[model samples]
Target: MTTTTTARPRHDAPAQRARRGSTARRETWGSAALLLLPAVALLLVLRIIPTFAALSEAVPLGSERSPWSNFAYIFSDPSFWNAVRVTLIFSIIVNPLQIALALALAVLLTKRIPAVGLWRTLILLPIAVPQAVSAIIWLVLLRPDGPLNGIATSLGLPTVPWLTDPTWALASIIIVCSWVGVGYWMTFLVTGIKEIPLSLYEASALDGAGSWRQFWSITLPGLRRPLLFVLVADTVSNFLVFAPVRILTRGGPQGGTDLLMYNISERAYTLGDTQAASAATLVLVLIVVAVVTVQFRLLPGRED
Candidate 1:
């Protein structure tokens, strides 16, 4: 004889399922937080701590000076003002010039040219060269009696003072920086150019759009994010340029090339003004921040 047995529901209740999902999410978040803890701790130790320390030391607690004496000293110093001017001039001149040149070079390299790979490699050769070495090479070429002037004299052209004259010294530095920088910036832009869908360009071409029109319509719009990144990074790099100034110019030619970074270094090392130098660094950070903020507003934002 068999007795009828009552059947139990095989599925969990909605509340039970919800509780299980909640528990799973909590565990996942806990594990993720645990994994991120070390990285966050390292960042705090390496960056945040040093930054706060510098800021605090800039206006330290002492009878030696007022609270903002360090900042005031730097702000009032003519040398610091000259550094600001030189740095601003360098950034304004070089950033656009470098980006424009890089874009042109990227387009050229992307075109169908014989031995294009070799040309790209040669252009990128400077990336492998140390900045100091590059600066020294340029220094040798630009020296008064160097090969450049010698060649100019042989050609019956007047010898131009490449590095000695204040008028041309900063421009010389810009040329050196641009030569070294364009290839590196082009690599980024070329990668961006490659990422655009070929169909877009093909369709534009089929529609009778010229290269200039297509560049403005398709290429520029497609490259908004990359261009913004390049602009910001290049701006920061130009503002912080120090090695070439240090190696080749040494901020000389009547202080025509005294960039902010070099000035800070000189103050910190030569004059032993760490506090004032820290103030200068903070000022530089503020300038860069302001510039980047403006750029973000002006440039097209990320893809929606």
Candidate 2:
């Protein structure tokens, strides 16, 4: 018996193409995940595992529940509280100073100034130097009889008690940190500034905006996202700063520069109090998170 044969519609081609396209996307995703696996594994192993380990040490995780004595001890300790204040103040002052200076440099370098390229290279030299090295150099410069004091003596200016006094010690650390960090941060600002369309500036200028007005209306608004990132990241970085304090004042003449990281190290090593150290470290982490969250709330919207 002859059966009537019907041809398949041309819509079959589109269905087959759709299937191939889906398959291709799956392959692409598979390849991407394969490429990302190593980084994810390393981060989990190095960062996440150690973080949890520290948290466990601080909070006590065993067959039986333990009292939160670690947290209690750290919270009650006056030095730990002082460290908290010093850390917050350091971040408060240094982050703004660094951002302002970096933003200024970013704007300045974008202009047609003589030897501007060389100036940028010079400014970045401190960033290339290791933080430890930079700290040591500042230690030399700021010591009682160092070049800075010597110059002051020659010029008959009052020399700063940079390291010996509690008041000046923290300020000295902030100055050193800003010196090393501002140029590094300026690079980010420069990238953000460059990403801003020149057309915006031109349109503003045509509408009778002067340089200051343009900066406020155009440049500042355009840079909101970068400023937010810089603000948050800088605050975190400054909070965790340790090496400069360790090298310069060892957490102080009187705990003036007793920042959270330095305080944690002192607890861990000098006092042989690992539990307290872990607790303090966790507190530091919490403070950073809280401050950053506040910054996100306070700053201009990221989407804009």
Per-candidate Cα RMSD to the true structure, in Å, reads 6.8, 6.4
**Native-to-model Cα distance after best TM-score fit, residue 268 in candidate 1, in Å:** 0.7
The prediction achieving the highest lDDT against the true structure is: 1
Cα lDDT for residue 40, model 1? 98
lDDT tens digits, residues 29-84, model 1? 88788889999999999999999999987878766678899888888899999999
lDDT of 2 by residue, 184-224 (tens): 88887878888899999899889999988988887788888
| Candidate 2 backbone collisions, by pair | none
List candidate 1 stretches off by more than 4 Å.
1-41, 62-64
| C-alpha local distance difference test of each model | 0.89, 0.87
Q: What is the lDDT of residue 83 in candidate 2?
A: 93
TM-score of every model? Answer: 0.87, 0.86
Q: How well does candidate 2 score on lDDT at residue 230?
A: 83
Q: Whole-model lDDT, candidate 2?
A: 0.87
lDDT of 1: 0.89
Number of backbone clashes in candidate 2: 0
